[model samples]
Target chain A: MPKKADNSGSAGSEETLLDAAGVKRAMDHLCREIAGALPGDCPVAIIGLRSRGDELAARLIERLAEGGRGDLLHGTLDITLYRDDVSKRMIQPQVRATVIDFDLDDACVVLVDDVLHTGRTIRAAMDALMDYGRPAAVRLAVLVDRGGREMPICPDFVGKTLKLSPSDSRRVYLDLAETDGADRVYLK
Target chain B: MADKTTTTAVRRRSGRSSGFVWGRKHLLGLEDLEPAELLHVLDTAAGFKSVSTRSIKKVPALRGKVVVNLFFEDSTRTRTSFTLSAQRLSADVIDFTGKSSSVNKGETLVDTARNIEAMGVDIMVLRHAAAGAPHLLARKVGCSVVNAGDGAHEHPTQGLLDLFTIREIKKKVEGLTVAIVGDIAHSRVARSNIFALRKLGARIILVGPRTLVPDQMRQLGAEISHDLDAVLPACDVVNMLRIQFERLQSAAFPSVEEYSRLFGLHAERLRLARPDLLVLHPGPINRGLELDSAVADGPHSGILRQVTNGLAVRMAVLYLVHQAALAVNGK
Candidate 1:
């Protein structure tokens, strides 16, 4: 169910574009749920798919730290070339660096993404992740789990679940006070 | 069944074992190689190394085979080594550079390869600027595929020669620490070395700037470090890599001087290594950038030894892959 916009902060104020505080709260809740699910002292690492997911992973790291959990390994992954539909794209996509500081062998990896939809991107991300090292298990975590999975996939922890029409496009925007004035999401 | 028996009988009658021979095919990447298969290629290469040392210098192993050097990129050392190796094994060599060929005339890579294969070329020695070009060509063509060097991908022959060179210098690969320094991100040599060295049981340390070394390299079981001093003392074989300036359009670093100061192997740095630490490079060295000339041509330098072993290793690779192809074809 889509949670009602919490109006405590600027989300209810006239300056509202989208809810930055609301997104943070939801991300924090999702992270706590994931942290609780992990076994004791089991080496856990979070690999964020590049671009927005990488930023999401970094933000999640800070939230995890606030909850007194500082033992998780963090990494950023690039899956541009590994996509099955790469050749069919009109423009040659930009390739980014994959940064996994630790070996994935036997480590429980939580693959964090900003949004989950058709499941195609997640599949490519998983393939790209495997080239680096074999993880014992991989779980998916998304901020928004919009229900339109074309492939056999489910998110382990989801911040919010949204139902959308087949033609509708949903976009998530993350902004630093340093880049843009605030953070938000929009649907068109 | 009769055709298969006849082909086997013909192979036996030729006084060559119906099992395998070296010059009739190509030697692509090592992605599909098992430990025993890799050993077979190495041991066969050792025999060819002996043949390379003989006075006659020529072998009839691939007398009628056509070995085309389809290099789509510029490479003096690797191209020359492959050409010489093919000639030594009595295969007719066709060397094509990208600029002078039909590749410049808007022809696709597969079309060009097919045109050459039409000329009865038995093996193709390919070197392209894109990773996986050889594998793509191998899938399209009926002839054998030998990858000379694909873009930051794999140089299997170079890797084999490096393995051969390391084995010759240290006499064993089982427990040695091999450090590959410089431009790890854009190096096919490093890619191949990782696979070859690991398969042979050597520990690998990849030392370079964080920008040049991919973070995923740790997944391949290599320890990544930016500080050369930290890794230098522990390495048994210091394999220096060439920093191809032509490939670098913009400076990956602030300056060459900064790179030299941080990562370049100078005389003082060499002194910190073990007394017997064998220094190596897949040559055309950028003297001051990745390595100092003093260390490159120094007493312990095995850079030239790597070049020499290139001939023997290529000869062995050609011989073994050809044998495997013949065995599969029932000849």
Candidate 2:
């Protein structure tokens, strides 16, 4: 859930587009939309991009359960080492496991993430997913769509679309099973 | 101020919820590493081992990074392995040997290193004839330094790979009796193995001639045993270190007959050891001089596994050093 905190005396101005309650409702709606269009005949793998994406994917799976498709295949991917601009980054890329147990030969993969910005993350996910096996189709889903796309890629399902400028920040603070406990998407 | 750098990473697929943190600007030797740090390298290498099995055995971990191999000494095996390991991680590698480089034209080591660093190399893999040569280079260069082999000081990766091989086969390091046989006094591999194995909780016994196994070997926490047969039964693993004839001064051991008869691991001695005994060599093996051809090729041998694990071990070292360098510079 997204809980936007108030910053009355900060240097920069802020806006709370959606709070924690709003995020849960948005996620519910997004899952309903994804459930309606997903191909039922084939094996649909709900793959989440690693770290925060896995958290978002877990929430999505819970929401999808309400729509009666809880049995959908799930996996998590780490595209850190797979990134094209790895050497350019000063920080060491933390490599985690990439678990895709089911065969992707003819599966429909719903790639999930928390925020959509440069669209480069999605592209890297696509490239990494290719190395496992060619999926029949791949549809992307995200909670917040802060549209500043550098790539030709776009999300299939977006919960909230915020057209923020370059200077504005969209920090999607998350509380996942594996990370520090907190969840909110603060736009400033 | 913190660099506020981000890696753009994903969830931990390593069955853990947290990221791995490693901090150390350079991997000077295993002697400097804590037990946890050494184990971490082995664990990290475990994740990278599967890369070799992939159809495209390349990972973009170090992609676009420049790695320089500066060697005052010639080492085809070590150099080639480092190149392949770096390339497998998608890093562009530059090779510079003493014979081919300007060092032959009277350029100082520091001058040579500064010039290479100016070319924007992110890491330097150095092997020099002098002990602590890489340590000097590490101090001089701003980039992360990996001591490939610095005379007799340490050949860290080689030691780690041997450790990796042992862990790979035996499944544990603690409570294992590992005997290091041959050229203890002159072998850099011995000096490194002593540090690594002793730190990892292995019972190490140095087995060779009295002249070859110096009194100083006891300081590394390894028992000095001149008789290979007496130690064979107690040892779970026997590492036959290469007899570096080039490094030897006059006649340290009486003769090949005397040395081989006393220390060589041949078939007759194999029956005396535990049935599950493992044999290891750091390679460029003197088959007849140290261990017989049968033992080197037998099922009990992890010599070839040592070679394969060498690649993973080196990859782990390179990746960890880069990670360390990032933490230091970023902070």
Candidate 3:
């Protein structure tokens, strides 16, 4: 998932990278890839990062259920309190509730997010998830993976790999119908 | 400060906007907080309410932060609630009391705070017998300051927890009449609650003998009443403040027994109130005086829940102030 505001500004040249149909195809492909990788009949905890990430996770759960994996656990992780750069930001992100009702112990946890850029959010999410309980395995899934990594972390599942400028001045946004009222991927 | 401007620009450029930005490094009182700010603290506390129920019961939000409890006044619940709240957020807590500390030797409050901050303390929760003690320290110290209680001034966290408990039990604060009964003039809790509840659109009735709750308190936008039973029927919530014998300069009332008979919330008085009237007490209660044992422990009581919510409110305050301080200092 791209770091939010990684290249924040008026889109230098705003363009739609993926429309609704393209988003659907990417999601379907990503779902199949995730289903094929997980062990059959294993109860996977489909946890999403807060804000748009949780929206994506909910959609992912519904998609997985349609594929006959109805035993997946749903959870939402709020990484606002876990971010390493809390003091560096001007406006403090609203700290929302992290609703993980089911036990994470020995369960397969799939962490979901919309964009992966600096990998800091995923780092924070992992730290937060570990506080609840240790899982049998934890995997990362994202809708968009734009280049530029500050941490040595990689995602196990990715919907689209976008190649933007290495200068980090371009923004990547994945808007879903659940949150933004439209499914579209755009570059700014 | 320069970093904030640049980062704020960056944040705006990123196309993400948060409606509220907590800008204060210290929470001295509820008197100055806007309605939205009051709701922000309550909402944040609501988010933290679930953290205490977890198996680990700890979060790394303040993992490396240090919080000092500097109490110039005696308190068991507020002090312990703050300590536990800091610990639950994984912050290192140092408890400094007025009796055992250098303040006993006539060391000024500023000197004590500066010395503690020199040791890299991130936040200081202060309780003093003097009003504006925390405010004075807030000006002198670079670290964040939280007012646990100050003489007849405001216990912001206590006010917040009361609001939290009210909102929890009643599902809202607006359009509800809350009667804050007993020791209003000498009660920092009553002062804080009046500011908070009034800001959130809840009508307030300050009930006590005229001596303890003066007529001048009406300027704070609360109806003053000497009759508890008269006010009880209209109140959706009743907060019973402890009768501070230590704070009284002279006899404000005739006697404890007389005051109990007139204003005490026993079974008889309780029956006069609404069936679902939420009862709250900032504890170390004069058990039979302000509240009876039955009512304090009864079904309508949010007394225990207030204590539980106290921790969450304090945690939210500490975490917010620490973040504000860090954002300002960029450390």
Instruction: Give the top-scoring candidate (TM-score).
Output: 3
**After superposing the true interface residues, what Cα RMSD does each candidate give?**
25.4, 7.0, 4.8
lDDT of 1 by residue, B1-331 (tens): 2234433433333222323333334567765566555665666565566445544466656778888999999889999998999998789999988889999989999999999999998788999999999889988998888899988789998888888889877888889999999898888889888988888789999998887887999988888999999999999998888887777767778888998999999998887898898999998888777888899888879999898889988876775665556544544
lDDT of 1 by residue, A38-134 (tens): 7555688888875567777887887787777788899987665445442222112223345676778889999998778778889888866776668
Give the root-mean-square deviation of each candidate in angstroms: 21.7, 5.4, 2.8
Candidate with the greatest DockQ versus the true structure: 3
Best by lDDT: 3
Measured with C-alpha atoms, the lDDT of residue B168 in candidate 1 is 76
Give model 3's TM-score for chain A to 2 decimal places: 0.90
Position A170, candidate 1: lDDT: 27
Write candidate 2's Cα lDDT for A46-76 as tens digits.
9988767887787788778777886788988
True contacts kept of each: 0.00, 0.18, 0.46
Worst 10 residues of 3 chain B by lDDT: B9-18
For candidate 1, the per-residue lDDT at A161 reads: 72
Q: Is candidate 1 or candidate 3 better by TM-score?
A: 3
DockQ of 1: 0.01
> Which pairs of residues collide in model 3?
A1-A115, A1-A116, A1-A117, A2-A115, A2-A116, A2-A117, A8-B13, A8-B14, A9-B13
